[model samples]
Target: MKTYDSISAYIEACPAEHRTLLEQLRAIIQKNVPTAQETISYGIPTFKLRGNLIHFGLAKKHIGLYPGAAAVEAFKEALGAYKTSKGAIQLPLEEELPIGLIEDILRFSVAAQTKSA
Candidate 1:
């Protein structure tokens, strides 16, 4: 496994095809959560506010999003088109990114993290 010190480093290491998508995603995340700290956690680009807020990464065929298990379940219906696990959602690379859904999930993560902290 590799290590990354920053979000740009992680995105730069992704495949060229996914680089732009990841950059756009990162921009949306930053625009939505301006106060969240950006860092590499668990070898992925993670955002932290009260704690860990959300994570995103480019994989072979998809973009993986980690907003924790609770957020996944909360937005299960809206995420029907994507492949989701207990704690991660796989957004397909060929399709357009669901920016609105992602922002809603981020809001859920922020609210939950804030309450716990």
Candidate 2:
């Protein structure tokens, strides 16, 4: 696997089409928790504030946001519009990105991580 020293490097590695989405997602997470450290975890862009708060990546047709297992469960209703699994929600590339919802999830995730810590 490739190793990156920073978030900018990781974002650079992504395809050009994914750049905007990645940047948008990165901005939201950073805005909510500026102290969070960015890293490439499990081959995707991950953020760590108090702990492993969230990880996101570009899929063939969507962006996959992994906000931990608990966050996925808590927001399952809101996430129903997308394809999801135990820890990820697939936001389709062709659709308008749900920035607000993503922010809420990130905020909740940061709080959850803090509580567990």
Candidate 3:
């Protein structure tokens, strides 16, 4: 599989009407966590700061944002409407993804990582 070094490279490769939205979300995550490392894992874009913090990807129906186990547990109520696994939360493209909620999740992920270490 092709891997991208920077989030821009990933954005440039995305093809769809939602490309802009995905890129915008990526930028928001990067902006809020400037020190995070960008990488592609499990065919998804992931950010690591101090430890693995989050992962996101585009799907045919929605965007998959994995904000770690802690975030998934904390946001269970808000995320209950979507399909989810142990470590991922599916945010449909039809719905306006909650940017503030994602940021808070990132913050929580950072703290979780620190606590575990």
User: Which number leads on lDDT?
Assistant: 1
Tell how far residue 19 is off in model 1, in angstroms. 0.7
Query: Candidate 1, residues 1-117: lDDT per residue as tens digits?
Result: 899889999988888888899999998889989999999998999998988888988788999999999999999999998899999999999999898998899888888987887
Q: Is candidate 1 or candidate 3 better by lDDT?
A: 1
Residue-by-residue lDDT tens digits, candidate 3, 1-117: 777876667767887688878987888888888888988777678888876788888878888898867688898887778888888888888888788888888878877887888
If scored against the real structure, what TM-score would every candidate get?
Answer: 0.95, 0.91, 0.87
Candidate 3 TM-score, C-alpha based: 0.87
Model 3 ranges with Cα > 4 A deviation = none
lDDT of 2 at 100: 90
lDDT values for all models: 0.90, 0.85, 0.82
Task: Give Cα distance to truth, residue 78, candidate 2, Å.
Answer: 0.7
**Candidate 3 lDDT (Cα, whole model)?**
0.82
Candidate 1 weakest lDDT stretch, 10 residues = 106-115
- Looking at model 2, the pairs that clash are none
